[model samples]
Target: MIATPYLLYLGHSNDEIGIKTSRGLAVFRPDICVGEFRHDDCGLTLGLPRLDFAAARDAGARTLVLGIANAGGRLGNDLVEDALAAMEAGLDIASGLHQRLKDEPRLVAAAARLGRTLHDVRDPRPDIPVGTGRRRAGKRLLTVGTDCSVGKMYTTLCLARALQARGVKADFRATGQTGILIAGDGVPLDAVVADFISGAIEQISPDRTDGGWDLIEGQGSLFHPSFAGVSTGLLHGAQPDALVLCHDPMRRTMRGLPHYQPPRLDDCLEANLRAARLTNPQVRAVGIALNTSAMDAAQATDLCARTADMFGLPCSDPYRMGVDAMVDLLLAMDAPAATETI
Candidate 1:
C-alpha cells in the first residue's frame, strides 16, 4: 500500500512535466503539497491543496514525494539538504529521479538513522534479459509522441480502457514513475542499461502466446536530443505491431527548453516509424492521439481532422474525442487471434 498523508515538495519545478505532476495530484489526491510551485494559469492549474512544510508535518504528512523531474539525473545541493531535513522529520521519501536516492550516501544514512524508507521510483528490476521481441505473441501497440510530456501516458490509458470496453484483454505497460503509479507496475525505461532497454521491455510484456492487446506507454521522442536514446530504445524494445503517435496541438515549443521547437507532427510520426522499422519492418502505425485540452472545441476538431488527413490514420483527442476509432483498428488487426476458439 502507498503510504499517505502525502506531501509533494516541488522545489521550483515550474517546467511542463513538473506542472503536470502538480496538477495531477488531484488524480492521486495527496493530503497536502509543500512548496512554492508555479505554472501557466491554464486549465492544468494545480488545485491540489498546499501547505508549508512545517504545517504539513503538523498535520501529519508522513511521506514526502519529490514532485520534480531531475532531467539527466541532476539534483541541487539545496534540494538534497531539504530532503535530509524531511527524513529527519520522519517522512519517508519517494523520488522518481534518474539518480537513485539510495546512491546518495548522506541521504541514505540519514534515512536509515531516521528509520524512514527511500523509494527510488526509477530503480530497475533484477535479472532483466536482452530483448528477443520475436518471442512475443501479442498484438502490441505503443504510443509515440512528437516530444516528451505530450500525453503519451494519457493516450495509452485511454486506449487500454477502450479495448477493455470491447471485451478485449488490454494491458498498460508503463515506462516511468507516474505511469507506474497509475498502473501499479512498469520498468523505468531510462534507468535500464542502454544495452538492456529492449530486454526490459521484453520482460515487462512477456509472451502470453495469445494475441491480446498491450498498450505500451511510449517515452521521450526521437526528436528530443535530451532523451532520444530512450525513445529509440523503447521503440525497438516494444516491437509493437501497431503504433499510435501522440501530439499536443497547443504546445508549440519543447517542454523545459524554451529555445527549442517541437518537430512537426507528420515528421515526428515518420521518424518514429522509420526507426521502429529498423527492428520490425512489419510495424504499422494505426492511429494518432492528439492532446487538445488547451484548445477550443472547434480548434481541437479542426486539428484532429487535418492530422487524420495527413497521416491517413484514425486520429482523435483521446481524452476529449474518445479512442473508439483507434481501438477499432487494433481490435480488427487482432481479429483472427481474438476470435480463435478456446
Candidate 2:
C-alpha cells in the first residue's frame, strides 16, 4: 500500500485538469490528505493547509504524493529536486505519472540511502493472467467517455456510493492513477502491456457470487486517437453488464487534440456498446453522466434533462446532482426500454 496521510505535491501546475490527481484525492479522500505542497507559481489550490515537506512529515504525513499531471507525464528537473528533498525530510514518495519514479536514478539512489520507499502506482504486477472471456457471476457497470478526463472516475465513484447507500453491494474498481489512489488498489490499465490490459482488469475484479456490482472506472475514450486501444482493452476485459456514458457537454474538441472533434453522444455510445459486446453480449447502457461543473445549476439540470430525453436513459450530473436515478435504472435492468431512442 502507498502509505497514507499524504502530502500532495502540486508543483507549478496552473491547469486544474492537469492536477486532477491532487484534486481527486482532496475532494474524495480528504481524511488521508494531510496538506498541500505547492510551489509559489502554482495557480490552483485544494483548500488544504499549505505545508512544506518537513512540516507535512511532522503532521503525520508518511508519503508525498506527486500529484501533478502533464501531457507526457514527464518529471521536470525542479520537480525531481523537490522529490529528493521530500525523501530527505523523512517521507516516502508515491507517484502515478507515466515516468516511473523507480527509473529515475537520483530518486532511486535517494530512496535507498534514506530508507524510503518509492511507490510507483503505475507499476503493474508480474503475475496477471490472460483473459478467458468466460462469463463471471457478478454484475459490472463501466463508465465510457467521449474523451479523456470526462468524469468517468467521478461517475463510477458516485454510482458505487449511491448503490451502497441503497443497500446494494458495490465496489469501485479504479483503472487510472487518480482512481487507483482513491480506491487504494486497482490495475493501471494504461501501464499494463497492451496484450495483457484486459487480463489485468480480469485479475483485479474477479467473479463474485454475492449479487454485488463492480463499478469499474474507465480510461480514455474510444474516439480518442491516443488511448482508444487501452479503452477497448478495458471494455473487453471488464465484460460489463451495464454502461454509463460520461461526457462533458462543453468540450468542443477531443481533449489534448485540438484538431479532433468529440464524438456525437449517439455514435460514442454505440461504439462503446459494440466494443463491449465482444465480451458480454448482453451488455446494456443504463445512464448518462455529465460533467456539468462549468455550468449553473439551472443550465446543468436542463442539459441533463435533455440528454435523458434524447437517449431514453437516466441522465444526471453525477457530481452536481445525485446518481440515484442512474442507480435505480442500474438495479432494475429487467424493465422495458425507457424510450429506445438510441
Candidate 2 per-residue lDDT, tens place, 59-139, comes to: 999999988887798877987999999999999998898889988999999999999999888988889888777667678
Q: Best candidate per TM-score, number?
A: 2
Candidate 1 regions with alpha-carbon error over 4 angstroms: 1-19, 28-64, 69-92, 104-107, 110-116, 165-167, 209-211, 250-267, 278-281, 335-342
> Model 1, residue 112: displacement in angstroms?
3.7
Using lDDT, give the best candidate's number.
Answer: 2
Q: How many residue pairs clash in each candidate?
A: 0, 0
lDDT of each: 0.75, 0.89
Give model 2's TM-score versus the native structure. 0.89
